[model samples]
Target: MNEDNAEQGVIRLLRAAAHTVGPGGRLPSVRTIMAELRVSPVTVQHAMRRLTAEGVIEVRASKGAFAATRRPTSEVPDLEWQSVALGAKPPGDESLRDLLTVPGPEMVPMSGGYLDPELQSVAALGAALGRAARRPEAWARGPVEGREELRAWFARQAGGAFRAGDMVVCPGGQAALSTAFRALTEPGDPVLVEAPTYLGAIATARSAGLRVVPVPADADGVRPDLLNAAFARTGAKVFYCQPLYANPHGAVLSRERRPEVLAVLAKHGAFLIEDDFARDLVIDGTPPPPLAADDIHGHVIYLRSLTKSAAPGLRVAAIGARGAAGARLRSARVMDDFFVAGPLQLAALEISVIASMAASPHLAAAGAEGPPRRAAHGVGGQTPPTPARHDPVGRHAGVGPPAGRRRRRRTDGSRRGPRRGRLRRPALVRGRPAGPAPAPDVRRRAARGVDRRRAPAGRRGRGRGDTSRIVNLRPTFPVVIPAHR
Candidate 1:
């Protein structure tokens, strides 16, 4: 028999066997099915694939096919008791869920907060991962604080003041934020955050059982006056902020206000969690030094991540602090995941080095352009200037004289005045203004009975007109007829 006939025959037999054995019962082996049906192995395998896809059976690897479970449609299980057992704590993962959701193929994502796949350095990441896998100690566990070289790299990126020992490598920025929140504040302790801050940070703070308070921010960054007021009002010991290209707002704290903000934190004797997440994404020019760079009193706890500029899967970040705060963060990291996987840490280190090397040329070029201009509002420093406007005649609006009065170079390389012609005015058709009249050459062509509909794509035609005096008409013309007969 043909292959299709054999497949159908085997499917029918399997259905019968499933009904007899019921759910979770093993069906006949592939060999047995082939022999019983007197069919070739290919036919039996094809039938099995169809059965598995249709939910009639499940083929376990290296094991025979088994009947799939079929739940009764009329009776739904009671999940009410579990809710009472779980208590009344609200679900706190909505923000994270939104962040982690993968958009469908049809979606044009305007808002998920990550580098586009095209923007991520895929080749560098792949190379790093490959090199890491080949390393002798790739699988071995390293220091819980992270590799010394990797920590040193992060320290160097921050500035000359920080040291490798002051840093604790975490799985990612989100984990670093969560660990910092739990280590720095007790349950119900208030944590001050910039109003309209990173949603992930808010979720992490709440998950760590800390109360979040909003401090209003402007173009430059978080308002120092309001920040001090928030500290006095709520007695919040910890403040979380992104000083460089802050999420959502993209505000970089101004040079003048940085000192003021830091002084406020010092006055309140509170810790500032500086999330320097976008240090590498400054496309136009060099960003100002991180808030942690000038910190002398160990007031700044810095968090930097490679996952945004690099690929998403490279979830490596560093948290830098000094004194007891740093110690507590290290302990929290240990308790959280023991240590990040060795291969991943090594891969992250390789990628960081490669990315920094790649960015050096761009940084040098940007340096040559001098520093970026500060924003008038003083919030996000160095905003790009607004583009120049253009006039209807295709010249820059406020630029030197009109296009017709300008000089032009002839084919023989001599400068001559621009050739001027009578500009066509827009015609009023059907009590509405129409587009400008066609040029003289186009009117001559129309006079020769050339079909306007046969004009090239994107060219529009006016209605019928005389050869001598060209009268442009609207595309649609109203027909008038007398009442006859």
Candidate 2:
């Protein structure tokens, strides 16, 4: 048996022995138990150690095992009274728990939101983190708004006219979302969201004491008319959306709906929190520019995270907004955690720069193989070879016939007729053929359904006597079943 099974068995045996042996009663020695159970001495010792730690038994250095005094049932303290002391507050952690749950060894995971371990750039992240750790100011307290260089990098990533001042580096995308929700809306204020949106967003909004209002979405993303109606009906000032390859369902907002969405948000004079979390996860085609990129009116609050693409522990993300909204976000971040760690900021910057540089070749290759190339081939960017039709067995037409068959040469040295089998069977090569020819009487008996193997030893064929017995055993004609009786 395995070590776990052996340990379990030892534990069970010890527990049973302890029940029979009263307080301070000596039990069987380890060697005796080991011999009785046919287990190793080490397993018995380990089990005894565990029981001793549990107060179920005690062991003296040179003496054998003894059962410890058990505590009376009445002496156990009651925790029932704490229910009245602690007020009711239902946990909103179900979504977070589901998100963080690791699949078992036998399971094939296709549910989680992050990349599988194999896809992550482990070497690049390690190098970046190591380099950042060696810096003298790695542990120093950073600015409330994050490092200026990191902010500038995020600003460039956000595109458009956003400057370093407009970016606020938070711990992660979730934290950025929470900060934005709390900073923008008052408690109980309605916040608009897509109907089938990120569960984390809903949880975060509810935790921030905001009323979540769902706006219907379609294959092209959130419907502009419904969003306008939701904003007007609920009087919501903040809307959270994932425009590019949304979570749970990968749906990219169409180009046509972009302007309509912007127009609706502009008309309502509200903020659109764009969670651009899947920017780095693009496997094919370039993702559209972020909503914040073209927002000249400061209506979009862009949040991008590196944790999903890189390692999970690298909890760094950036939020970009303009004017008063950006100031509010910075203030909220400062109030939340003062600032993100300087080493993490440096590491994020290094990783982002290195990842981008490394991705350049892949991006170039993808670009070189444009739509025409992809369409000409199959969807996976390579054309599959067509099968040959001339070969009767469906093997490659260019291959020669099977072994032991040679083509006959004609007068002009040209092959003619089909190839014949050359390899001789043992029976065929001997005086008898491949299979001995059966007798006519045996064939006739077989056709008549006679069991020759079950016939008498002297019987050679279905003679008159066998025929009479077969007729007697045959079923009667026009057979019928009697009713009731």
Candidate 3:
């Protein structure tokens, strides 16, 4: 085709897309455009580039292209990444680790949690590999809502002993979370949250352009009345909390308070985002039923993570969404990616099944079955803290208890500067009140919360990928824990 014809064809596609978008209320994929425009791959690319650049559409990583990003859209375009192709440039000096890495930062890498797949049980993974290869049928693009087997297993696990029919597999806890945020809040809307809930969820809310209003919490989790007050004060639409083994605090919401919390959520028409993260490793108490357990109104969007339980490599999480919530959550996933990874999801399904059997009384304890030997290195700190499930970088970016229980914060919207005395990156924020406040004491850095993790170098390969992380995993997820309220 001539260049002029190409341009005309491109214009034709754009107008068609605009019309299609007007009626369909969503952007069609490149494939649909090809079938519709009856053009080649290059033609669709040319047209999409024009649309995305013109602010008429957006090509969101992982979520695919959507309508132009507007207010309450996303936290920062820098963070919402999909696949990091090998050739894909590293965050171009803005790498995730860049924000965390400190200058002269030669400490014993004990700053955070890391889930190296090499540290996982290879024998079980090998069996899973065989299962997948034998059934290549598992390789097709699986449901964007996640495979039914995984959802059924998740449903069985949600709410302690709830039926499997209640659960739906979300691509990952993050995807499930973003969906929950959309389902519960509106653009430019304010919502209540645990002072320090999952950071990824916070980013997701901001991406949707939801105004965040953090509520206060202690070691036992958020105070119910305080939460209620935040709801009333902010006229918030949703209540986001990590009820069990919460992300940074590593504390479970007290069982006695779970019902009251849910009641408050229901009373307010606010859906409770009980990020039942870290369920597999409750360290101290008997796992309580999730807040979704007795959800009288379909108000709880309970999220479960597998990164901690089976393996982070699975990149799988599920949600036990009730009523119309399930349908909405599915919509968010579809708008992002038509389908979740097929083989990995199938593998996740099988592993989830294994986790259920292993955790059950009928089967021996998963941990007791065989603990992988840790490499003996002269480590300085106490036992490395178990990684929390949510992304720490996301958490570190915003530190401070939700609203009423506010802690001191640096001018920039970042975490309360690294323990008591870690190196503080005071530069990278929204803005700073200009003034030479005081010559800060450089030698005053000391550890605040004692939870430290150090995954030293020299690791073997994992079955999932040909990579080795020098640190620990992203708070390795708890296997199959029930999602019943």
Candidate 4:
């Protein structure tokens, strides 16, 4: 009669029916069980749920529940021989693994290498992906070098002499780095990297069997002298560096040091793998051009990625080189994953997506306008002669200074500058300076006249029986607090 008793009775009847029907037989319908047992549908559903969870029955959508099939158990086989067949443990990148490990819900992550989920343009990216999915070409296999349009856009981003023909679209920055490492060097060859470079680069190089040699870097980026020394000492053919906003340190290679770095590479006849990962993340001031832009003889192999600026799912990156080096990178990319997914490549280059990303506050500062406007918009048809000061998606989108006012910046990101005169005070406050305090009014005071001279010291000028004190909350700031008796 009760819910629990009814449920148990229904479950018992269903079990008997299943036994009678044998395995894989249809169980009694909920309506039939309810009609025969005189029980509610909830009771029947509860019993069915219990049976389903216990694997005593299987529920198929549209079709009624049926008895579950019982398969015979087999003996477990040992996998110990796998270790012997695989031989010694391959080098483990514990740091890289830890970097990629996601934290639990209770944990607040401070170590994640990617942009915070709060800052990602999830809605825009999703919409773009949806649009891309509808295209017939998105499902088709793209060129191994990547979609032509995407490559051309990357060329524009790279600036310099790099062209669409020179670009190889890879899955992401990490994959591009791995492909470059494998393509350029043989196993056990020394590859020079900044001392505190991106861990993914180190992990990729080591995984590719290349010996990583560290070249010290400072606030201005990798030290030219030390880099030169390392190249001479190790005879390394490849040197990886982050020119703008280097990972971990946020160091931008200084104007003075950029030429020196290139000279060092040229002297050693080595290649510089410039990872311009943060090119689009410039919050203030103009970003410098990629080191690859200055290279005429192909000493620089440039890499630019949208993964950081856009959502992490937009793992599109361009790895580019010139002449023979470019061919090697393209060949290497073909062997690794063949080509990036067509939908992802198309999404990155889609005009709608590019416009959406440019307008997104997550990608740029709110209300930032004016440009070579080319950089702020999508790169579709022709390539520009020079790269824009910032990545199109990551350009600083702050409004420029008003006419005749020179803009200056402060540590807190507030704008300060010279103005013609003091700002007009509110007239409603009777010509008195507008601030936290109320303006003087003789009429108001006279009407509510209470002799301030006769009032208690603590209550003077304040409402009746005021016992408040202004406390100095030192080390933070002073605030008015009420001191009750």
Cα shift from native, residue 323, model 4 (Å): 1.0
Candidate 4 TM-score over all chains jointly: 0.65
Q: After superposition, which runs of candidate 3 have C-alpha atoms over 4 Å from their true positions?
A: 1-119, 160-166, 352-485
Rate residue 438 of model 1 by lDDT: 15
* 2 versus 3: better TM-score goes to: 2
What's the true lDDT of residue 129 in model 1? 86
- Model 1 sits at a Cα RMSD from the real structure of 18.8
> Candidate 2, clashing residue pairs?
none
Over the full model, what C-alpha lDDT does candidate 3 score relative to the true structure?
0.52
Q: Candidate 2: worst 10 consecutive residues by lDDT? A: 476-485
* Residue range 1-485, candidate 2, lDDT tens digits: 87778878888877888888888888889888888888898888889889999988899889989889766778778898888889776424354544344533322222345544544556667888899999989888878898998888777778765898899998988899999998899988999887556667878887888877877555577889989998889899999999886653345777999999999989999999999886665545667889887788999999988877676778899898889998899888888999998888888887743347336443233234323222321112121111110111100011111233332221110011011222111000001111121110000001123331132222222322121111101110000100110
lDDT of 1 by residue, 270-331 (tens): 99999987776554456799999888898999999887657678889999999999989998
lDDT of each: 0.62, 0.61, 0.52, 0.63
Q: Of 1 and 2, which scores higher on lDDT?
A: 1
In candidate 2 the C-alpha lDDT for residue 439 amounts to 10
Model 4 spans > 4 angstroms off = 1-77, 351-360, 366-485
Better of 2 and 3 by lDDT: 2
Candidate 1 residue pairs that clash: 219-379, 219-380, 220-379
- Among these predicted structures, which one has the highest lDDT? 4
TM-score of each: 0.65, 0.60, 0.55, 0.65
